[model samples]
Every structure is written in C-alpha cells, then in structure tokens.
Target: MPTTTALPPSVLISEVGPRDGLQSVSRTMPTAAKLAWIDALHGAGLREIEVCSFVPAKLLPQMADAAEVVRHALGKPGLTVMALVPNLRGAEAALAAGVHKLTLPVSASAAHSLANVRKTREQMIEEIRNIAALRDERAPGVKIEAGISTAFGCTIQGAVAEDDVIWMAEQAIAAGADESGLSDTTGMANPAQVQRLFKRLRAALGEHAGAAHMHNTRGLGLANCLAAYEAGVRTFDASQGGLGGCPYAPGASGNVVTEDLVFMFESMGVDTGVDLGRLAAGRAALANGLPGEPLYGMTPEAGLTKGFVYANGRRPATERLLAPLAP
Candidate 1:
C-alpha cells in the first residue's frame, strides 16, 4: 500500500459566502450578520474571503452592502479582503472600498458567456482589458483575478470544449487579469476532467492560472478538488453550507461546501489552516441571517468520526466527545 504523503504546509480556503452563497438565496442576510459571519470565518483561520460583489444594489439586493462588508472585512488583521466585480463600474466600487483582491467572472463557453454576461468570450476579454486599466490607475496594489466560469461544461452550450477553456485562461491573463481560475458553474465536472483541465490550464497560463471552483451537484466536489490539488492548484473557492445554485442550471448544488472541503483536507494531513468547528459556528450564524434556507454538508451533520485528528494533530471536540460517551 502506498503511504500518504502530507499535503502542503498551508493552503488557502477562500470563502465565497457573501457572493456565491448569498446570490442564490432569496432572503438577504442582515448587514450585521454579514459582518459577524465574516468575523467568525476569519476567526476560523480563513484569511481570504469573497465578501461581496460590487454590482448594482438593485441587481443583487443581497449584497447591497458590498462596500460596508468589504471595508469591515479589510479591517481584520491579516485578512485578504476580496470582492467580485462584474464590470468596470463594479471594479471602481471595489477599488473605492479598498478590497485587497478583486475578481471578475469570464465564461469559457461562448453560449454560456452570452447568456450570463451578455458578451462573447472575446468581448469579455476586452472588458478585462478595460478593468485592468482601471485597476492599475486606482487600485495598483490590489490583485485582479479572472474567474473563468463554466470551464468544464455548460447547461446552455453543453460540451464546453477544453481547448476553449484553455484559450480563455490565456486570453484573460494576456488581457491583464493578474491571475485566472476555473469555475465549474454547472457542476458537470469529473475528477479526470478536473485533473486534465487544471494541468492544461497551468501549462498554458503558467503562474497566472488560479484556483478551481467546483460544485457538489454530482457528489464529486471533493474528488474533483483533490484532483485539482494534485494538478498543482493551490487556492480554492467554497461557500459556507453550500448555499448557492444557478437557477438556470437545474440541480447544481452551488459551490463546494467550505466545512466539508476543509475537513477532507485536514483529515488527509493537508494543512488548510481552517478550524472546522469554528467554520460550523460560522454556518450556524447563517441560519439566523437567512432564515429557512437549506445548508448542505456531511461533516457538519454526521460530525467528525471518533479519534478524528486534524492535520496539526489536535483533536476536534467531536472526537473528544466519543470518549466512550461517559459510560
């Protein structure tokens, strides 16, 4: 049997709660809960989080307080404040709010691109160009990341060619996106597909290639994430409680669950640096924030198995409680 080698010393779990998690839900989280959840996530040792989107408040009332959330999160020591920007206008707002990182979504599937952002892949690249110029002018120290959504497959276009995915990553980087990442928007990704695509993307974009954003629609979220990790991807995007989904794409289980993904990595001796118990506490805060929304995850429900030791060898309370149940 092959012995399991320890994973990297530290990995970044970029929380997508304020953006990916909130966008799909109908009820908007209260501004105070948003702040508290962000604080709790930071307390759980998550340094990076996509706190909000700089889109118009009318479009996503859920994130109407993007500036406030970004400002508040930025104040937390060592936290890399991140926010999404859909266009140049949004980028301006993000810059004004002093976000440490700004992400923009560019679709590889041309059909999906036209449907979601109402732009061709090429047009989206042009937008990246414009956004890049604005970033250089206003937020010189801030990072720009292009999140290439629907890179694996698309519900609208179907069969998003791998070549197109690679091409988009290269184009986005060339167009001045500081880094580029892949998002499996429709959740039609497999482990093999993930490993192959991330390998090709790394080869094509070099260091500019970014993290893998996956979904659990097919119950392969963790498997695909592991595949990507093996392919040399470092950062990952996950939502608290797996709350979001594409209304357009049926059965897509939003983003990967942060707690479960953290558990998978920590259990395998990978240092995610996130505290699962504190992450669950963050999720619990979500209930009061967005009442009646269903939060999904196995780790949070079944709890960690007995003797569950994290990568650092610390025993989680779940394991401690299994001490013969005080019989």
Candidate 2:
C-alpha cells in the first residue's frame, strides 16, 4: 500500500502515444506495429489508451488507421480504448469502431477555438451536445470525455481567462458530456494554475471531471500533474517516451513522459499499478514499432537508479543492470 499512503490509493495514467504521440510525428507507424505496441503497453499494466483520432484522413493521414486500431484495441480484454473525435462524424466513426471512450477538444479561448477547430466556443458546446445525444441514442455505454484544451493559456492568444475555461466545462457537462477535464494545450500552464483549475473543476463538475492533460513545454509537466494530484485529480494523460506536441503551438514539448511519471510516483512509494521496467519495455516496443521516429523522456535514457523498489517487488533485473550510467 505504498501508493495508498504516498499518493491516491489508485491512479489511472491514460497513454496517449498512439493518438497524440504519433499524430505529431511525420512517419506513419504501420498498423501491425501499432497493434503490437498497444499490446506491449497493456502488458505493462496500462489500462486506458488513446488509440487514435477519428478525423478526416485527408486532414491527418497519420490517423487514417484509427478505425483499424480501434478494432484491434477493442479485442484486448479489459483495455479501455479511447479515440479523439473533432466533430459528430468523427464521433460516429469512433462509436462504430467500438471504442470504449471518446474525447473531443474544446478550446476555452475563442481565438484558439476558431484557429484550431474552426468553431466558436458556443458552437463547440453545441457540437458536444449533439455528440452526447447521438451517443445516448446509439451507444449508451460508450463514455464521452470533453478535453478543454487551452484551458490554461494559448500561444496565439496569451493569458486565457480561467473563468472562460470553467464556463466551458460547465457547458459541456450540462450538455451531457460524461466527463470534462482541462488540457494545457499550449504548454503555458504552471503548477499554481493547474492546482487552481483542477480544484475548481472538481468542485464544479464533481466525479464527472476527468484528468490533467499536460505538456512539458517548460519542463513543468510532472510538476503540474503533481499539483493536480494534490488537488484530488487521479487520472493523468501521458505518452510513452514523451512523444507528442501541439503542431499549432511552437516550442511545446511532447506529452508528459510515462516512464518518468511512473518512476516519480512509484519512487515516492506511490503505486501507479504500472511496472516501470515493463513500462520501459513497452517504450522499446514503441520505438521498434515506429522506427526512425524521435522518442523523448529522461527516465528512459537515464535509466532507473539503484535501490529502486517497484510496488510489486525489487526492481527487475533488466532495470538493475541498466541503472543510469555515469554522466
């Protein structure tokens, strides 16, 4: 029960590499490799995965295999397969693909919304309502998550108002979104902002509030996640090897590194239910799956240190042998 006392009794780290990670990279991972990587991640004890975004193939050729990936993920037992859908059509495609969860990004900043999705804030809310209604009528059990991107600030439009983010969350929840959470789209979030926003979101939306999706643009991704955890947020969205960034936002690092985050929490006696050694193995699978794609993360390259005890037992032999080499 290390995590029980050190951190929340339980935490869910949602892997976003398949969707968010690959989308940002230029090379397309073959469908078979992507499937194998997903299998490896699940074997490492990752329960939820954002497999792909259900957008127009013409727009993001990388995600053209979203339906195939979704189908593959669904075949894995106890795995929660999630997909990003920009509009009602994408949502329909996602549901038809039998994904367990669907997330739609709704920007809090009007300018960012218009730039990213070509819709105003209100129009995005309406889209969520329509999608929710569609899900209710068609796939009653598929979970809908509203990812409020640019909840902190935007690169194009700086200093996004917190009130605006909270209002958007309210509107999405009111429109029947199963859950809503904030995304640091521009990587402009700080620890204080993350703590405050998540605290307010949980207070407003209660259990329907989702995770903290952060980027390491300023190297504060892990810090922001810790702040959210302190504010009672358990679920986190991360990518293997930190592979993901906003194409629209310059200088933003990839998603928080799954290996490092797991190490941070588990090292502090927090149980993430993720085996760090196995997680690294999963990352290797990821690399092999998409060769030539640049992967990011400190822990993977630096390796684990001595006396690192995982929640299950002593550090695996592979990790012990590969301890961080002398700098």
Candidate 3:
C-alpha cells in the first residue's frame, strides 16, 4: 500500500449503519454481530462511526445494547466513537459509555419535532443545552453536534421554511452545541435546496456547521450530497448497504449508501480514506447478522468502473487513471 500524505482526509464519511441503519430495521442484531460489523466499518477506514442511539430499550429495542457497542468501539485506535442522543438522559448514558462525539437530533419542522421526539422545537433546544452542560460536567472532551432533522421538508409539515432551518441551526449553536448540521428527514430535498440551505446554515453557524444526512427515497441522495459538498459540508452520515430511515419520518427511505458515497467522492478526485472493497465486506457482515434485509446502493451492484483508482491510491489524483486493486 502507498503511504497517504499527512494531509487530512478531504471528506469525512461518518458511518451510521450501526445506529441509524439498525434502528430502522426490524431485527435486533446480536451485540456480537454489531461489534463485528463495526469493526469491519473501522477496517474500511471510516474514522467515525455512530455505534448506536441511547433511546429507552422499550422504545427502540434494537439499540438496547448501546453501552456494550460503544465500549467495543472505544477500543479502536484513532476511531471516533459517536452515538445519537435524543434527550439529556440519552446524552448522559452515551457519555458514561465513553462516546467521543454526540449527535442530538433537533427537528426543524415543528410538527416533526413533536412527533419524533415528543417535544416542541423549543424543548429540543433545551435538551441540547442540558446535554451540553452534562458533557462539560462529566466529559468535557466529548463533542456535541445538534442535527436539525427535517431541514429540507417534512412529510408531516409539508415544506420546512428555509428560514426555519437556518434558525434551528443558529439556535442549536447558541444553545451550546459544538456544531449543527442538516438532515433531509423525509428525503424530500432537491440538489438546489440542499445547496441553498447548507449555504445558509454555514453562514448562520460558520465553523459550527456539521454533517449532511440525506436519504435516497426519491433517488437524489448522491446529488444532494454533492450539492452539500459544493456548499462546503465536508462531513456526511451514510450507512453501509444504504441501510437507514427515520421510523417517524413517514415515507422516507434509506440514507446515502456508504459504498456509493465513498465512490462518488473518490471518483471525483476527493480522498475519503475509505476502501470500497472493505466496505463491501462490512455489508456482508450486515447481511449475515440480519438475513433477508433488503440492501440498496448502485455501486455495489454495478461493478467499479474499469481502471478505477481510489483518490488516495499510489498515484496522485492528477496522474491517476482508475486502476483496479490487484487480486
């Protein structure tokens, strides 16, 4: 393998398969299989992985073993262990489990907020504030990201106002979040809308702008991701095998597929530091853990383009033609 330069990875692909992906599925993956799947994701060079959410077991039984999964992920050297926290209690639990990053979902659509988190937008802001305070008290090192779900449009609320999305991101920052990002909760975002809103988010929050979580329900997942990139978003939340959807987000589908997302960037001469071959192996683990789950993603089905060379491969991007990995 060629030594990658010291330059930071051009994009950060945050694997959300273990958390968002699993939660959407019906089966409760055994703790061991989840651990194995996470290891595979790490092996594929994903530096960050959301291992699970800290919701109550009765509400989301799939994530009942959040602590154990976090514990296992914590052992990975140089890996950022992340988890979702819907409230202060969830934040506390995630902090206790030693997560390095916390993503708190605060819906942008008023109706979605009430339906998803059982709180108004104001209440969710309060939760973000309290969670930030708790993080400072116990684990000052843990970074908090306030994710503004339904930032584009909500199935329940119809269309989320662009101003409201900006306001939510700004408020989240003022409420003590280290960063605030946008999510297309209902998968209703178009490329233009994605770029426009992200530009506004960056303007409102500046350096605190975070990840883009887009869904592929309407088949614009990759395009929307590209639009966000053009708008300066460098962190993205994707799932292996395209496995994720918000249970509360009626009619929404899977998230941007990790394999496809990685390929998109790498093919564009942007280094994502992810190995598609290894990502496929991770998908295999996902299938083995929960048989009969319908996986999605085009790259996984259409073989890599001939002469495909990863952006971080031996040759520099300018000189590299796509080269297949040696068998």
lDDT of 2 by residue, 220-327 (tens): 999999999999998999998888866334444668988888878777766788877667667777778776566667787776777677764556666531222122
lDDT of each: 0.85, 0.86, 0.87
Answer with 2 or 3, whichever has the higher lDDT.
Answer: 3
Model 3: how far residue 29 lies from native, Å: 0.7
Residue-level lDDT of model 1, residues 100-202, one tens digit each, is 9989999999888888989888998999999889888887888899998999898887898999999888999998998999998898899999999999999
Per-candidate TM vs. native?
0.93, 0.92, 0.92
Error of 1 at 103 (Å): 0.6
Question: Model 3, range 270-293, lDDT digits (tens) per residue?
Answer: 889888776766877888888878
List clash counts for every candidate, in order. Answer: 0, 2, 6
Of models 1 and 3, which has the larger TM-score?
A: 1
After superposition, candidate 2 runs with Cα above 4 Å error: 1-8, 247-252, 312-315, 320-327
Extract clashing residue pairs from model 3. Answer: 307-322, 307-323, 308-322, 308-323, 309-322, 309-323
Best by lDDT: 3
Worst 10 residues of 3 by lDDT: 317-326
Quote model 1's TM-score: 0.93
The residue pairs found clashing in candidate 1 are: none
